[model samples]
Target: MNGVAVGVFVFFFLLVTIMGFAAARWRRAKALDNLDEWGLGGRGFGTFIAWFLIGGDLYTAYTFIAVPATLYAGSAVGFFAVPYTIVVYPIIFLFLPRLWSVSHRHGYVTPADFVEGRYDSRPLALAVALTGLLATMPYIALQLVGIEVVLQVMGLQAGEDASWFVQHLPLFVAFAVLAAYTYSSGLRAPALIAFVKDILIYVVIIVAVLYLPSKLGGWDSIFTTANDSFNAFNKENADAIAAGDAAPKAMIPPAAAHWAYASLALGSALALFMYPHSVTGVLSTRSRQVIRRNAALLPAYSFLLGLLALLGFVAIAAGIKVENAQQSVPQLFEQEFPPWFAGVAFAAIAIGALVPAAIMSIAAANLWTRNIYRAFINRDATPQQEARQSKLMSLLVKFGALAFVLGLPKQFAINLQLLGGVWILQTLPAIVVGLYTRWFHRWALFAGWAVGMTYGTWTAYGVPLPGDPDSHFGGPLELFPGAETTKVYIGFTAFLLNLLVTVVLSVVLRALKVPEGVDRTRPDDYTADLGDEGVEAEIDPHEPAHA
Candidate 1:
């Protein structure tokens, strides 16, 4: 192990840890027992804090590691992350402010809280809550992958000769500290620690982008190296593709991958804001203005994301080689930078994993506490009991993620995350569309959700990984149904199918005089600001919020 690198990493990590625990009193709210206080950092964050928090929550360790890894492995298709982030802000701007307004006006905590309040359907709320919890656990598992890769490059975790327990013990120790602080601090831990994570990431990625290229004869040499390597890699894969022995993996996806590229971009954009952790960030902000301003400003992270993606090609020019593509960035830093700076870069990535993991665990815990435990288990838990349960459940969720990474193959975690995106996007028809018109019957929307979830899972299960026909759930790309020649993102196809079913079912159900649920909101509710006074559960049967 590299002692100096480990030393520096430990220093920054411990510093962040201290900051995390202190954040319990950072804003000094009136009480820590309520959902507003514990689940959402008192829901009083201003522009700057929310900016870093949302950036930390959304960009994730995956963006830093996997985006580059994808580029390193497949080429142009990996850059899809950049454009997806660009489009997401504008799209969320259209709906997120309204979600925040409605949720804030009604004192709703989780997205499911809003779903149940808007539709007056406990089952639909439970469906949203369960989906969020399921989607978040695998995402938390993937962060450990980021941490393990960093440790491997730091010489802390390596060699098949090492015992499995010994290899993963460091990771367990790190996450344990994360769990402790998050339990004590709630959302505040991640909100406070995000400052450090984002700063280090920006510094390391910016320096890597500017300084590394000149060492390898600049951008021209970098792209030339990447292109030449891809040519060689593609030539070998061509025969395999002709025999249906491999799926498309290349610099550009060739003629056949256009639909997949566009669909992936669009599907990812739609799904990004739907993640519970992303909504937690949006809801924590002080006002709708905060959400609007950030929509224009947060694209800065997307700019950084694009620069980070280019590091894959740079790794090629630097002659970096690693068995796992995830290790490409960490190993590159270990080789090129001095031991001390390499440690800093490694710490940046590990901390990157920590911030999002903390937020994700909290988000999942909040969902369970509010929508699952309270709604189903007790139905009468006080705010204090809710906070207590959330704190304990946060620990359970993190350890569950630990079990996920250790008990199964890493590919299982990766595939689950892919499915998570698809699954979470299925809720869009119910939650997002409900934010506007309440014309759709709650039961009809619920049925549509069921249909979309079914079709999406079955199709995703059929996407085979080239030579491994027996092992499916390989990637998000699949042939559009009824047109095998066209491959597109499974999530978008599923989302479309979900919307179409909702429309058809709504028309039939409306004609049959199905009873629409009570809406606990008003016209002004959708535009409510931070300090608005409101009454919830106000449903009018004559006008079921048709507007």
Candidate 2:
């Protein structure tokens, strides 16, 4: 084991653990017995705090591992993440502030809560809540995967002959710590810890990108080496490439992949904010202006992400090699940096996992307590009861994610995460479109959601790994139906079909005189600010929801 690196990693882990539990007192609320405080940090974070919190929530540990890993593995299209993040901010600027306003005005806690309030349909709201829960599980598992990758690189794993429990003891301990602190501190845990997480990430990435390139000749040398490596791989695998048993490596995508890159970027951009955790971060802000300001400010992370993606090429240039591409960057850090600083990088990745995992668990738990439990099981539940249920459910959610990592194959989590993007994107018509207009019949939106979920999942299931026809969900891109040569993100294709079905069905349902549920929000509610008539300084869970 790398003793210095492991020691440094442990010290930082303990520091964050202390911070996580202590966060409940950082922004001390009058009571922790309400959904508003426990689930959303009292919904009063201003621009600065929201920026770090949302940034920490969205740019996760798996992203740190996976983005660079893709490039290291010679998939040029993997850099779509940089552009995906860029495209998302403008979209967030346009719609999310409106969502923030309405949610604040109506005391909505989850996106599903807003859908139910907007359509007055419990079943549709349940669908949204369940989808959020399902999509979030694999995502939380991916965070564990991130932590696991770092631990492996740190030499924390037991020998190959060790029992499964012995091998994964370190991971289990990390999972326990995450669950305990998140249960105690709720949204505040992640919000407060986000400050440290974002700072460490920036410091590490900036140092890595700036310092490493200079050490390895320069940017020009790095690019040339990476290109040479790809060409060598292609030349060696010429037969496999021709037979479609292996993919050709490229530093830049060829013309045939242009649509693939664009579609992944566009699909991912649309799906990012739809995640329950993203909604949770947005709703935690103080006012609509906070959301808008963060939208403008968050793009800076996109810049960081672009630089971070280059580290994949850097790994190639540095002559780093590993069986798992996810370990390439971590291995690079270990080899290049002194043990002490390498530990800091590992800590950054592990802590990065903690922030998002905490937020996602809390977000998923809120969906359960509000949409499923309060809406169905106990309609008359009190605010304290709701808080208690969410806190307990948060523990269950975290452990459930832990089970996913421990019991299932690692590849399963990664594949489900890909499907998670598509699954979560299916909620867009109901959530994003509902933010603009209520013209969609509630039933039509429900049908569209079902159809989209079904189609996206089925199509993704059929995509084989490059060489293995039997493998499923090998990647997110698929040949666009009716277009032989062009491939697109399955989520985008499914989303279009969803919109088409919703529109056509709405016309038919309207002519059949099917009921459209009453919208509980006023037109003005979507534009209201903190001091406006119905918008409260602190939302009162006891108060009746807006009529």
Candidate 3:
């Protein structure tokens, strides 16, 4: 059972648990009974804290596991994560500062809050809120999947013959602890713990990338071994590949899959900031300057991600073999590292899940409290009431994620996350484009979102796994409609169709003089800084959201 490794893992886990609870006291405020304090840590974090928080939030446990796993599985486009992360920084540097400005000026806690204030359409705002909630569920589940993979490699999971509850008892205990501290300390828990999380991750990745390659006969040997393995598999499976019963593995994507690779990278970049957790981290910053500065600095993690992705080849070189590719990295650590350091690696992964899961649950809860509960259920809800609702809903959100991991097949998690990218990207026309112009009719944006969501989901559902035609959502790429040979990311294709529909409908709606909802913001709102008029160091929860 690797007692020394398990002990080290437990020690770090306990340390974070203590920090998570103590975070409520770390940032003492007047009270956490308001969204600003509870959901956003008083919106006073500077560039340093935001850098770690946003880094810990965006680069999740799933990235640690799945990106390497993709390479381990020999998916041609597995390394798309590196390019997408590179692409996202420039995009956020351009627009997220504007979102930060408007959100602070309006006391908007969630993106839906911004949408409703901008468009004055409750239904459209509700759609954005619900989409964030739906997309985030499977995402949180992927974090749990990360934790589960670590536990399995550590010999912490119960035997397969054990009852399901017994089998997942450790996972449930971790979830309960995460839910408790997040509920008690709110955003402060993750914001505080992010410092520790990022440090451990950096240490682990740096050591693994540097030391493991040397131990495994260097990078050249690693790549050669991985390529040879792929070639061997392809040669053995030649008949099956020709009969469309198996995929041909490759070190680099073939010419035929070039569009698929590019589309995945671009599509993921466009979708990254649209996630609620990403917005929550941005909105919690002290100023637009902090957002901009962090946008510039966060690319350091992308460099780390590229190194981490190469570890998949390292695992191959080390002769690490597991039926599940997701387990390869964890298994590699167990086999190669000392028992104690292996524990640290496992703890790094498990703790990595905690930070983002906390942020995601909080982000989802904020959406429910602002757009669903207050907007639809209680028009006169107070700030305290909103905070209370969000706290309760955050618990429910985590539980929903727990249910997802328990009830669903874990193999499809990567696919579901891609599907989430497709679903959340549908909101870009409303949120990102709305930052620049209000030319889009609210109803038209809403219609476009609907079409994109429907098409993306249906198309993803129709894609069968390469060797299993009966399976669904087996991958993110599909044959481009009307181009029999070209395959592209479904999200990118869906987003283009959404833009087309939104633009056409806006033109028609304008010609018909459709009622364009009132925009409560001014041009200056998008450019406002911390010291600007009506922009405060900390948000006033009592102020009317649209005032």
Per-residue accuracy of model 3 over 1-547 as CA lDDT, tens digit each:
8999999999999999999999987656757888888899888888999999999999999899999999998988899999999999999999999998999888899999999999999999999999999999999999999999999999998998999899999999999999999999999999999998899999999999989988988889999999999999999999998887888888899988899999999999999999999999999898888988998899999999999999899999999989999999999999999999999999999999999999999999999999999998999999999999999999999998888888888867668987999999999999999999999999899999999999999999999888898999988889977886678999999999999999999999999999997899999999999899978865443533221
Stronger candidate by lDDT (1 vs 2): 2
lDDT at position 132, candidate 3: 98
- lDDT, candidate 1, 1-547, per-residue tens: 7889899999998999999899987876655676677788877788899999999999888779999999888645678999899999999989999998888777888899999998899999999989999899999999988888888788787478888888788898888899999998889899999999999999999999989988989999998899888878768889886788865456676666778888899999999888899999999888899999999999999999999999988888899988888889988898888889888999899999989999999899999999999998989898888889989999999999999988988877898899999999989987988899888788888988888888888988987776988887888878876885678888898889888888998999999988887888787889887557752222222322211
Q: How do the predictions measure up, each by TM-score?
A: 0.96, 0.97, 0.98
**Backbone clash count for every predicted candidate, in the order shown:** 0, 0, 0
Name the lDDT of candidate 1.
0.87
Q: Alpha carbon lDDT of residue 207, candidate 1?
A: 93
